[model samples]
Target: MAIRITGTGSYIPSNIEKNEDFNQHEFLNEDGSTINHHNEVIIEKFKAITGIGERRYVENNLNTSDIAFYAAQNAIENAKINQEDLDYIIVGHNYGDVKHNTEQSDTVPSIASRVKHLLGIKNPKCVAYDILFGCPGWIEGVIQANAFIKSGIAKKCLVIGAETLSRVVDKHDRDSMIYSDGAGAVIVEESTEEGGIIAHESATYALDEAHFIYFGKTNHPEITDQRRYIKMYGRKIYEFALNNVPAAMKSCLDKSGYDISDLKKILIHQANEKMDEAIVQRFYKLYKMKMPEDIMPMTINKLGNSSVATVPTLYDLILKGELEGHIINKSDVIMFASVGAGMNINAIIYKY
Candidate 1:
């Protein structure tokens, strides 16, 4: 049984915020006159580093659900499936319009229902709603949907990865360069046809040492309720990505009964440039494998890291000819790999 991605769609905000615009924001500079060299350097370096020139940002009136609706519409249209056929809507997101105490208990059900109503779908049987592993949530959603659809729990499912990470970024902080807003979606259906999610695998490392990405304390004094902003140990994450992501990728491929040469393309998470290079170099040196030149294009440069939306948004660019000259073939197998904040690493093997 194969779960096919019949249609793919993505929505980027119309607002075009360029590098010079970000540089002129004044908050990017530390002391008004003196700018941080690393910050300024990365803004310029990322263009050449990742190949992303611009990313989309929804304005004040828009929310994740709104962007998601647009992407879903496009995917639905592309899939050419009737609305009545959709039995599930899984939204993979970290930040939502409203805050919640736990990741699992967010307003995703309300979101799914709202989207179903907007689409005029007849009594859609929505199921399995929640935010899974932050940036890796999108892949997790697809895997879950695959299981359900294959098990006869669903005939058609819509899996959407949407994020508004810009809301949580501390604009004054240097790490703010990695957060952006966007959404992307795929319509997965039970198909005997080719080109869909084939095999998925997940692995976790329970390391307290690597848990330096968050801003909250385990035991904070006072009756503290706070909106903790994003903080990352970039060097630590880079090291972690280099060490764990490749192993995870290989493990996933092995589980799927595939070899290094069997894959046609690789879409690693759009976190940063340096980490992506490490994985590519390791594959070349150890496995004697050559990654496609366009595999690690600069998506984070314009959009920053749209959390879960990263890979799907980049997929849109490739499919839309914005990322021209990239060789994606009809029967090509692609690998999606990532090292997310939970000290979690995941990889999914797909045929497209």
Candidate 2:
């Protein structure tokens, strides 16, 4: 049996946080005073480097599950399937719901369960759970759904990638601007035809570089808990991406018996524009050919990095014809790849 993505949907919060807002965003010194830097210069430099001018942030009134529920509902509607037909609901996330006032992370009942309840899915047979594998969690969720379908365990499954990363990041830190909030979802169902995920490859480089971007304290230990917020060694992660991501992508293509020429578009993680461009460039070099212009689509400039939500959201836009000059044909091939925290990397190849 073959597995196919029948529908896709995404939700990005309406609230936009511009880079200029960070100027007065309380970047403080140890004793609670401003750390001196030309805020305008920093904002411009950040835009030039990451290609991000603004990103959406969920308001205090909302939670991760809320966004996931919306995305899942939209996906179900798009797939033209009855809600009761869903056999599984798998959510990919890093931090569960975080209560801002209490600074608490809650995972006792999985976010997927809450989403299932809110969707009014009353089927007792529909399994729902969460997965954590750094930024690759969503793709991993899809991979597991594939196993379930191919093994005759499921007929239809909903895979969702949702994150409210702004809640986990220290607004004062330089890395904070790269994180945001959003959710994306897809309906994967058993198909008699052969136009779905053809092949995939993934791996983890368990090293200190893995810790380069992780959940940890603010640099000023006097102010907050030791493992409270997100922090990173940018240079270390940049190096790791350049060294590992392209190889994993190529390995995935090879597994599917494909070459660079076979793919129409490549959707990569929207973490850093500079790094994403570099990774694709390196992947083409492995074939001794240059990547075609406009072959890679990016949303990082506007969406920032919503962790696992990025690629699925990008795919949803393309499918809806919401992106300019980006469209898929009846049998086009595409590749998706990403690398992030865990030093984890993953790739997927599919036909449309």
Candidate 3:
């Protein structure tokens, strides 16, 4: 028996926010001081470093759970599974649902529960819950589903990673440009398939890096309102990921007993282009080999960083032939990795 991903789906918002959209805003430093550089130069620098030309935002009428439901509906339809037969619904998210133009988040009923309701699954045995593992949430959800199947607790699971980072961002901060909204999902179940998830790794570095990425007041400190937004120490996160993520990926691949040469594609978190490139390079370095061209597929240029949604969204796009020049064939070996708040890092080695 193997824990196989039977189907995948993602909901990419239609509302596009381009790089030039911020040209008229007043970018501010952490200390509330105005950035001396012109908006054009700042945006250019951001684009060059993150490779993000545009991002998507949810419609004002929609919320995170709504998008999660959409992705879940797609995955269920793709998998052709009966909703009543689902054993679990696991949603990976950071901020719950932040309505448009609101500083408050609503999590009274968990996103998973809301999604399950929206999906119209009435089975009482269909357990549902949420996880807060930063950007690796979707990968981690898959790992959890694998565990449930391997332990005889579940037969089919719906794993979703959804977020509305745009609602939680400090517009005055430059990093705000990196935030977007999206949701991706997959149906995992026990199957007599040859290729499936083989190995995984997870770690949290909270000792000194606990607050590397956090929720705090906006860069415009003059606004005395108690509203807090998503914030991070980009340099610290970059260094933390570079120093540790590659090693985690290596460990996962090694545990899977697959040689570096067997890795066909790496669907890494769309955090930053340069940082992701460096991580893959370092990962290849561990095996004394050069990183293969087209070995890593990316969606950051158009999607920005959608917290938990990045990896699964990228995987969904490639699997559906929506991402050009990227394809996953039967029995292909691949890896999914991500790093984010909690200073957390994780990787999953899969055959498929």
Candidate 4:
């Protein structure tokens, strides 16, 4: 028996926000001081570093749960599984549903519960819950499902990572450009297949890096009304991820007993372009090999960073042939990795 991903799906928002759209807005520093650089130069620098030209945002009428439901629905359909047979629904998200123009997050019912309701699954045995593991949440969800299935607790599970980061971003901060809204999901099940999830690794570095990515007051501190938005120390996060993520990936792959040469693709979190490139390079260097061309597929240029949603969304797109020049064949070995708030990091080595 193996814990395998049977199907995958994602919800990419229809509304596109281009980098140039911020040209007329006022960008501010953390101390409420105005940025001396022109908006054009600032945006150019951001694009050059992050490789994000545009990002998607949910419409005013939609919330995080709404998109999560969409992705879950698609995953269920893609998997061709009966809703009543699902054993669990796990959602990973940071801020709950933050409505348009609202600062408060509504999570009383939990996003997983809401998604289960939206999916209309009637089985009482279909347990549902949410996780807060930063951007690695989706992979972590899959790991949890694998545990449940391996422990004889579940047969099928729906794992989703959804976020409406645009609703939680401080528009005046430059990092706000990296935030986007999206959701991704997958159906994991116990199968007789020979290849599946082989190994995984997870870690949290809260001792000194607890607040690498956090929610704090807006950069424009003058208009303070107790409204906090998503904030982060980019330099700290970059350094933290570079120093740790690659090692975690190496550990996972080593545990899987697969040589570095067996890896067909790496679906890493779409946090930053340069940072991701460096992590992959370092990962390959550990094995005394150069990183292979096209070994890592990316979606950050168009999707930005949607936290937990990045990894699964990229996987869904590639599996569905939506991401060009990326394909996974039967029995192919691949890895999924991510790092984010909680200063958390996680990786999974799987066989297709």
Quote the lDDT for 84 in model 4: 90
Candidate 4 residue lDDT tens string, 55-159? 999999999999999999999999999989999999999999999999899998999999999988889999999999999899899999999999999999999
Encode model 3's per-residue lDDT on 245-276: one tens digit a residue.
99999999999999999899999999999999
Cα displacement (angstroms), candidate 1, residue 298, comes to 4.3
Worst 10-residue lDDT window for candidate 2 reads 26-35
Which runs of model 4 end up more than 4 angstroms from their true locations?
none
Candidate 2 accuracy as lDDT? 0.87
Model 4 earns a TM-score of 0.99
lDDT of 2 by residue, 34-111 (tens): 667777877788899899989999988888998999999999999999889889999999899986555888887999
- Local distance difference test, each candidate: 0.70, 0.87, 0.94, 0.94
Model 1 residue 102 lDDT?
A: 27
lDDT of 1 by residue, 6-120 (tens): 8888888777666555674334332324454655576776566544566566776777777878888988888898867788888877666633222222464555665676677
> Per-prediction count of colliding residue pairs?
4, 0, 0, 1
